[model samples]
Target: MTLADILASLFPAGHAVRVTDGLVSGDGPLGASRLAVVGIADRTALGVDGACTLSRHVLDVVQSGDRTPILVVVDSDSQRMSRRDELLGLNEYLAHLAKTLLLADAAGHPTLGLIYGHSAAGAFIATALATRVLAGLPGADPSVMDLPSVARVTKLPLETLQAMARDTPVFAPGLDNMVAAGAVHAVLDPDSPLGPQVEALIGQMGADDIRDRLGLERGGRPVAHTIAARVAQDAGGG
Candidate 1:
């Protein structure tokens, strides 16, 4: 079965989930059960418009006293590469998703993100904002262009680029780099005990109460705490 299929199985009766055109999308079944799954199709192909529309709709549901758990399956290597997307304000679309996730959290929906593929730029940001982030054994990687893209962007030779990636955490792919960067929270082999983990997360869901097990708290991601730190510093407390 595909990863999407496995995720769909995580939901039970009254859960809304389906795979259509390669996008795994769903919503709450009843009056608001903490359960929904959104899958990213070709992370690089997902643009701001689509992300904005989908994420906005999700937020609308959350505002209605329905504390549904939103499961995000992120696997994109980059945002849309078209100039049209930028002209149309891709940043705004991505920001909309961010706000929606924050709203979901504030409304008591436990937002869980699962990374089974590439993640980069907007894709990375969207998932990182989730309350919990889970990574597949091979899911963690550069989440962006390989050394070749970096070479082009940096004007460095491919050989030199690869060597640098090996030494620099920024360019490296795989689980270690993502983990060190605080992108992935927990690493699990496909064969590992996912059921129990899911249950544990479900039991821990709360209204605006986040558990710092994976991405936000313990995952060594600088950006995670950077916001809070800035706020605290601004408040003259830090």
Candidate 2:
């Protein structure tokens, strides 16, 4: 779906969002409350300027002192891969955007991500992955890292990486893999009204981050939750 289509489906009641340069920000009615919406659109490559812009909006929401739920609608390319972006410290800008979202979540705002289209790499992390709950619509393609890039980094053959991905959800790209790895908490039915599904998800959210546990239960990265728990326990004892 296009961003407009997704927004209409998500806010059947109404919305006041503005999209400029692929950056989205606004509010939408959500059953007795308003959801503060912020995100990227148009499959644009996220850059330092986009990251800083998003972070500023999130910080504005946080400072408002409203316990409003935040919705991050994502449709982005990977972080911009240009010499200019590198020289401008794109990583730091992305980190700031992620931190601002985390702060909003920590400050009693329920932060949720809805992926309706392509999202990848650091752009995915700073927006969708930072959210407490991430839901995806059918055909949402979110990739932390693509196989070609992984092959280059790991010095593994492309065919070998593809074969491994077939068996493991660990670093694969797709909605199924993301769900298996617990990056996506839910996949809404495209046949149904998305507004109700989004509302239900908001109602079901909890304070704890359960992605690791979900990953273990779903048979993706089976040792992650166990190792994390052990480390936490050991740190507390020390």
Candidate 3:
């Protein structure tokens, strides 16, 4: 089955799933009955459109407050390639949606994400902003795409590009690599106690905030420290 089909099975339906084109935004089972979900179809699922859809949904959820969960489901392929989208303020829309997500967290909402499909680039970044991130099995591919695609524009060689991807978390695919970079909070089996676990997370949250240490990133997960050390090094300090 596709990612949406799997998520539909995992998250019980109660929220108002918004569907415009092929983009869908909603709070799965943990969300309130009136939560907004949006979907995008075809090439229209480009930059500005996707960002606008996300912004609108986020705003609606923030206005709804603690009544619903902020569960984001990611199953995207890529961002806008249209030159018109580039000309338009697509970046503004992305920033707007991102800020709205932060606002949702501050307003006491459980922002959880289930990535059952490809979460590439902006779509991946959007989903990862959640309080908790869950990846189910090996169905998802999280590459920034192969170096050949980049090389088509940059004229870089396959060997050189492959070498770079070997060391960078940015180019890795699959959940193992993503988990190594702390991109996901946990990996759920299709038959695991996902629902109850999510509910437990909701109950344990004294406030809407998701604790970094309590989730999958901490508790001696090897990748957690690896990613952390990278960040620290990037920041120019220990």
Candidate 4:
């Protein structure tokens, strides 16, 4: 879906968001309230500049003191892979963006991510993965790393990785895999109106990060939650 289509689905009532240089910002109606939107579009590869721009917008929202719900819509490539970006400290910029989102959530502004198109790697992490809850639209493609890259890094054959992905949610690039792995909190039903589903997810939002528990409950990463809890308990932090 185009960004326009996504906005339409998300706010059937109406919206006033503007997309400039692939950066999305503005407000939209959400039931009886309003939501602040900060996102990327046009399949942007988040470089240092884009990351800085997005972080500023999120910080503006955080400083607004409204506690408005935030929706981050993502349609981006991985972080820009360029020597120039590296020299410009792209990692720091990306981290800043992710931290700003976390800050928004921490400041009582419920943050959610809606992945309507492809999102991968650092771009995904600094946006969708940083949200309090992430929802994927049908056919949305999300990847932490692509198979060929994983294959090259692990010295495994492409066919082997593909076969492994079929059996496990890890090492794959699909909405279902992400959902099973608990990275995606929900998958919006394509047949239903998106507005209600989004509202329901907003209503269900809590302050805790529960992806590890969801992974265990969904049988994806079955031991992750237990191990985390054990470590926390051992440290007297649970």
What local distance difference test score does each model get? 0.61, 0.91, 0.57, 0.90
Give a tens-digit lDDT track for model 2, residues 118-137: 99999999999999999998
Q: Give each model a TM-score.
A: 0.73, 0.97, 0.71, 0.95
The local distance difference test score of model 3 is: 0.57
Tell me how many residue pairs clash in candidate 1. Answer: 5
Off by over 4 Å in 3: 1-4, 11-18, 26-44, 129-136, 144-146, 149-155, 167-171, 200-238
For candidate 1, the per-residue lDDT at 129 reads 40
Candidate with the greatest TM-score versus the true structure: 2
- Sorted on lDDT, best first, the list reads 2, 4, 1, 3
Instruction: Tell me which of candidates 2 and 3 scores higher on lDDT.
Output: 2
Error of 2 at 90 (Å): 0.5
Instruction: Report each candidate's C-alpha RMSD, comma-separated, in the order given.
Output: 4.5, 1.1, 5.1, 1.4
Q: Write the per-residue lDDT of candidate 1 for residues 23-43, one digit (tens) a residue.
A: 557764422334576757554
Candidate 4 global CA lDDT score:
0.90
Report how far residue 98 has shifted in candidate 2, in Å.
Answer: 0.3
Clash pairs, candidate 4, are none
